[model samples]
Target: MPASDSDAPARAPWWTKAVVYQVYPRSFADSDGDGVGDLGGIRSKLDYLADLGVDAVWLSPVYPSPQHDNGYDISDYQEIEPVFGSLAEFDLLLAEAHERGIKIVMDLVVNHTSDEHAWFQESRSSLTNPKRDWYWWRKPQADGSAPNGWGSAFSGPAWTLDDTTGEYYLHLFAKQQPDLNWENPEVRQAVYSMMNWWLDRGVDGFRMDVINFIAKRVELVDGPAAATGGGSPMGPQIHDFLQEMHREVFEGRRGEHLTVGEMPGVSTDDALLFTDPARHEVDMIFQFEHVGLDQGEHKFDVLPRNLPALKQSLSRWQDGLAATGWNSLYLNNHDQPRLVSRFGNDTTYRYESATLWALVLHLHRGTPYIYQGEEIGMTNVRFDFIHDYRDLESLNHYREAVEDFDLDPGTVLAGVQTMGRDNARTPMQWDASPQAGFTTGTPWLAVNPNSADINVAADLSTERSIFRFYQSLIELRHESEVVALGDFALLEPDHEALYAFTRTLGDETLLVVANASDAPLSGPLPADVSGAELVLANYPADPDAAAHPTETTLRPWEARLYRL
Candidate 1:
């Protein structure tokens, strides 16, 4: 039987209440005019982050890498990327961040390693090499083609033939990033050892990348004859691998540390097992279901987002995991487009929509994540030409769609504009200076053209800036126990543009309503908010409205919270 709300476990660890800020290291800040952000750059901005009231900073991968997939293709697990900083700089950043009561969570990309990594290098040396089993390598089929029909996420076949070994290796992502063979005990041990080394250095936790793909199906069969490409995300051994990782790396050090796995194509049931405290797998998992709502089979093929579908998807996860597990709430990240541009209005109603989105996400019974530029209501970039995009996946897909598939270039460009990951990877807009104050040198990627008006420096002093609104939301989560542990109930789930929900803990209940549209909405209270005390709102609502609450008018993208 499904567990009742009363049977739910105790309030989660500190992380459950904590607001995590994800910093894309390469674009967050640049200190040395190197056109790239580094550890010192992040350290320099510690005061800004602390002022924003986030509990932890989740840094995207900064490990040594060839950077084929940014820093996800790690070449050395134990060392910091030279472009980012050295080991000493990392330690300094950690120490300084902790001094200000901020925890640091490193990105752990263990699903694969760069081909330049020593293990992969040795693995490809010869079939008889000692480290041959460190990565997934298979002999070519009789037709001299790939070992399987699996596809690469970046386009084309997932298998890349290694001339030195005369065999094909699996890479679910880019060809340069060869998937690790977690079936081999030594590979798992190496990953754990690297994690331990970082933990011993005072890093608080890890945000594991594509962790679900660690264990692929043993049979390595073809996905579907009609499939474009990409191997199965979930494998039979995923649970075993995660359990082993917990026992070996996180068993005794579980307390005070966060472990969130980024699992693509993961179902709610699989997420429960992965996050169940008794199972000891992970503290939480980042599921892609919500983000993929408007995305077609291919991410570039955009579709209209349905409000009911989104509410149903999120509500199911909230109810499914209420008894034992936790959720990580977010709308934007390194691999996704900016939330305001994708889901909310980014023009005249930018601030209103951004804050409304924040209210909706943070008020949910889960830990909220704020992407680097999200607090300031950053919009997606408008790069006129494809060359302006630096994302490998975006570039490859654009080429595949236009050149191979013979699709219209204009159509492909429009899709790329709407869904490209590069939209979120533009340089951080610190000020209105040249290059948006990111660096004196030319930025690796173009700074958003609108940064002159929409930037941190300009918003810092604005009374109703999106940044200040996000700060208030974070403060609320920290102050209200009900916000942290309340049982969630979706209100008006069928409403096309109104997203309304309530959180109940003991006798205290909080109602949150947002008009997730560009037009004004007026309606009767979705629930009994008769005696609700006005707690928060993105726009100034008449104080008398709360006294006699028969009906309310929500401004464009307006959001409100009331305590009952």
Candidate 2:
């Protein structure tokens, strides 16, 4: 195992102090003229990421797959997909990333595998195959229906019938990806072997997909439907399998490897259990509470809620996890919409609004993660037809809205238009060239229409661009101990327009303030803080802006960071 100095502070553990940049490989860049992103394309972008000051890059899944879930469904763990590159190219990318002081974390989809996977193919060949138990299969009901009434995450019943076997298999997501039977000891051992194999190849760590879903309700009892879609409750026995996974794959034998779990549908208290360092289940976990703030109950309705309520939830999670375990903090990801269009005024004040939103989340208590093109303030695409959508989740939701709910296609498209996974999957805007230079031929997904005006090459040269603001933000956190590991205290919780917080480590203090409203209000700084020095701001205070205290108003969606 690789070793660092034992005396190094735990706060400065390899991952906590490291800034992570998420690269959705398909959209990031294309180098081989294959019209699809490859490992070589990622290698070409290493210098750009390093210059942006991120210490690590977490690439979305690149393993062999049918692209059922945009590579989230894996057919083989040990080899790179033919379209992405060869295994040798993956090794080259890893080496190049390390040369730039950036660690690479592979996405590990352990909860399931692609139906085309060799293991799943073997399991489904017959009712009495050697690997029959490798996946969850249940006997059909007397009525020949699925054993339970659970709903798939994408939509409709969670079970898919295997006519050949005369049984049903569980699929939380698309039917093409079957849930693995983690209860099988052989399955657990196989997962562990894969982990070791990747680590042996010098991959830094793993961003575990649906880590908490590995466990399940062994009884397979029916659950009450959700209030809206009447979906099934989360699987049972999730924690039991998590503990086993920790012992075998994550902790007992691995040395200082980072593992962040996508433990959706977890409560703050439940999240505490999965991330407790002593439990060894994960280094940290990404909570989706903030991401779903504007979402309606089981839907995306665009109904605005009180900002304080959203702030309160974030505060609770931040304070709750501050000392107990770590946090994988982010505002956008490949599975979510772009933050600029969804959360901020992306059209009118793209730069300030986007940077303000970034400051509010990135400078918090957890380790910050930046998604591809987020630094450049990417906005959501406006598609005209249902055929425009590519994500499986969006397609299912649209179908459900039109056929099951009897809703008009326009309204359903509007809902998905405003909030959908495809927003984040658009080909990255690298330059003003055709298709934003994301591909030489046609892109796998359409590029944003505004790409010509919002590409990275343009932002890199502009001093006041959102990309530069993020670059500055990254530098501030890395250079300041208080921002990285100090105790966090959210101040002025009731202030409607002011989002303020302090990070103090002994005598050093850092203050983060965001003007969340179109107009600004002022209050005295936190009672304990004095003589604050302006560090970074989306809109810097001019002499006149700095002179007035109570009257010092901020422009719409302004944000600032200070040191004391």
Candidate 3:
């Protein structure tokens, strides 16, 4: 059991202290020996999630898709993909998860639809089709070039010429995912109808995918020369559309649901507006500032992590949203590499570093999210060859770097190895079985080769395992209001390797310190932490040592929490 702290105030919103666990449906579990996980597999694992103490499960998109960009490219909004299961199975999973006190938050992907969608099919039938204006279509330039210089997020131009229609259409991502024309009132109504349908079917909330890109600039002009053919991250009418969405779908049902928009390039100032309760735009926004700390111009161009810069980014968010808005804290997700592999020492100090990262993220004043397998300290997978990689983004970038730019294939492969989405898409390591206990047949994607050693089964019975540490942290959040609603203050802003901060509420103050690197660190305790109670630590503390020690020594990647 985790320790409880009674000295704090209650937070009104149900999600303030909630911990969300993200489950990428295809990779989570496979119950039917079909090599792919389905709703039944998730239903079978409800007990595990309940025992893990998460408040909700944010499932990645399981809608009917063509699998071009995994499940993000949806062909049908109302039906579940056959590979995942039917609507009946989804209902059963929802019921089972709710029975375990876990809310189900569906992944809402409306930024674009798969080219096979009925609307897109009709839109492309002819230039004069009523549905034609539902998508962006433009005549080619006089020189037979694209309408604009916008680039596709996948690699090439955003505009693709249609031979039959004799015009080009816009697709910000893969050509198969054509962006919807949000300026159309009918489109907005249709989207809201879909959202209301899901909510009526018992989904607790939505984790909207790339929702900010739904509203593009009216003129649809070319972006900067180096811009990744995806147009503006934020457009002039984004807020208007969001506000209208709130009025249409969430006006009277505010507190009954949660809405988090995945805004890739949102800054703190814009986040404040997006999350302001009075505005009703969204409950929260997942900003990318901190996650991009170790990347250069492009995501594949990896850079050394800078602790001070990271601290500044996170601290600014904490301070900026301290009053009006809220935040969603996370390290790993379906789109990013595993946290332990990217931010922590996944080899020599895997357990310690995982625990340290969890402590820092959970102690902050925000709702924390844990990606599947992260609790067990999953590391990035290294596919020996390009043939093993399955993510479209990785494969596209690899082709552009090696074939188009003439970059060294080995160097490009190394970058993909370090920062590919496939690293997080590998099947969950359930046990030391031939398929990591995820399936009886071959997995849709290769299970990480190291699953035999780093798996949930091996860690479940271990008292000091990373899974256990995460469980304790989640329990603490449920029991301690200070962990959820307390004010945040950075303690060592300039510390190169140690991330330390304080959380205070009324008469209660908590200090959290973590050694983010693989070296021992000794430092003088923060000014007011002298007599604080040693509430938690990755490594067991010396019971005989003085509680008010002036200085502290942290072992490699160690973390400690003190309550004053």
Candidate 4:
């Protein structure tokens, strides 16, 4: 079993030294051959993660739901969905993970619940109902329209009218998920109880979804619509409620439990309030500033972003969080397209590009998160039609393009193909078998067409596969104390084609160099220091290349990690 932190010193938190592996359960491996991954399938893969040297596994939501929001809209948190597994299966999976020194962190999506949730069902029954205050509800406008122009994250008005109750309920996402009213003391107590209940059941921690959206703008001001007429101002009162929540529930949580917040629109300055160790509100906040750097006028537009722009944003996050709060470094997740295709040349140098990007992000001064199938260098799915999309966000954007903006359906569908979450939700590729080794039946989402060439079974046999490179990188992070908690400094900020940084802890120093461009770039070492050991290189060890003494020559998309 994993060493119990209960018996360890209080100062050394397990998460601080841990590498987090994110498992989008459905896209991870399908052990039942049903084309959809489940808890048992994840249970079977614990050994793979253990061998890869990951310390924790952050499982996406698996709660009972209508699948309206892909399990984010939960009807029941206390029970596992039949599609995934039974409650007993979850316990067994947890135990199995612990046995391999891998901690499991469940995704806590308390910001909203499925309209099918008992709480929402009761709240929507009647205005005078006992549970009416559980969710945000407002009276209709004089014209019988929405209460305000506030927009949903998925695209339309945030308020959903219920003719039965003569009120409109707020939902930042799909109308199927009504936002819970954190203003209600009863609701706050209920959420706290739920958190305690899960922690008591042996979960290592939680990955809170849209945590900042828990508290809304009490005044309910009408937000200015986006140029696309879909923008919504994220509420102002969010911080206050989060502070209160921390004091009441998270202040004295048992065992060094980790808490990572999905707080979009959080500026670097505001991020400090939630992430500062002294405040203890959250261990880290997933700042989306870097991810959206390349986004176009529309949310789903797959516009190209400049490499310099990406480097600048990444540097800003590193510098801003250097002393305030920690960062949860990641390139892809359930919400993003595959990094290999999005930022790198996934077709030509897929494995090389994936390794280079991983080296650039993982070696930074923060806890790294690896999405499932990413280590094998997964690429995005290609769809010829909009109907192929499983994500609500993509569908909403496509509708806007076709119905409102009058854009060509083909163009809109092509954009969705590039940026849709369905690209990331494809079934995990185990082998070049029937159903891409995902399942015997048709999967909820289709597997990537290129899975045959990049399945785990094939990569495991290849010495130079992206998966093996990731394994080496992860092992290096765990064994080197300096890499885990070193001070980070960006080197050659103006180097247009190079993303280089130095991580140092006292006299122990490690330099990470990446040729961000597609073309070869040769340059002098960041410093005049010597005796640098070619500890780990994405390419062959370049003794002759280093023999030149002063300058370093890096091949196209080359990446290297050196210890001095």
In angstroms, the error of model 1 at 87 is 0.6
Error of 4 at 304 (Å): 2.0
Model 4, residue 556: distance off in Å is 0.9
Task: Assess each prediction's global lDDT (C-alpha) against the native.
Answer: 0.88, 0.80, 0.88, 0.81
TM-score of every candidate: 0.96, 0.94, 0.96, 0.94
**Candidate 1: where are CA atoms >4 Å away?**
1-11, 221-231, 543-548
lDDT digits (tens) for residues 163-229 of candidate 4 = 7878899898999999988878898888878877777888888999999888666655333331122
Ranking by TM-score: 1, 3, 4, 2
**Which portions of model 4 miss their true places by more than 4 Å?**
1-12, 221-237, 251-253
| TM-score between candidate 2 and the true structure | 0.94
For model 1, residues 1-564, the per-residue Cα lDDT tens digits are 112344333534787679999999999999888899999999999999999999999999998988889999999998999999899999999999999999999999999999999999899999999999999888777678887777888998888998997999989999999999998999999999988998988999999999999988766544333233334656878989999988888887744888999998888888889988888899999999988899887899999978888998999999988877888899999989999988888898989989999999999988999999999999999889999899999899999999999999988988999999999999999999999989989888989999999999999878888888888899998987778878889988888999999988877888998999988888787866786677888888766466558787788998889887
For candidate 3, the lDDT comes to 0.88
- In candidate 4, position 501 carries an lDDT of 85
Model 3 reaches what TM-score against the true structure?
0.96
> Candidate 2, residues 1-564: lDDT per residue as tens digits?
001222224436666667899999888888877678778888888888988999888989999999988899999988999999999999899898889888899999989999999999999999899899999898877788777777888888888999788899988889999999887889988998898888889998899898777877654543332112232234556666767766766565545577888888788887787777777667788878877778875655766745776778888887877667677788889988888887778787888889998888877877899999999999999899989889888898998889989988898898888888899989889999999988888888888899999999888878778888888888877876666677778887877777888777767777887777666555554443234578888875646445553245566888877776
In candidate 1, the residue pairs with backbone N, CA or C atoms under 3 Å apart (3 or more residues apart, or in different chains) clash, namely: 151-229, 151-230
The residue-by-residue lDDT of candidate 3 on 1-564, one tens digit each, is 011233334434778879999999999999899999989999999999999999999999999999999989999999999999999999999998989999999999988999999999999999899999899888877788887778887888888998888999888899999999888888999999999999888999999998998988655444333223344745869999999999988878744588999997778889999998888799988988898989998889999989899888989999998877888999889999999998899999989999999999999988899999999999999998987899999999999999999999998998999999999999999999899999999999999999999999999868778888888999999997778788899988998998999888767888988889888887676655656688889998855336548776778998889897
Give the Å error, residue 81, model 1.
1.2
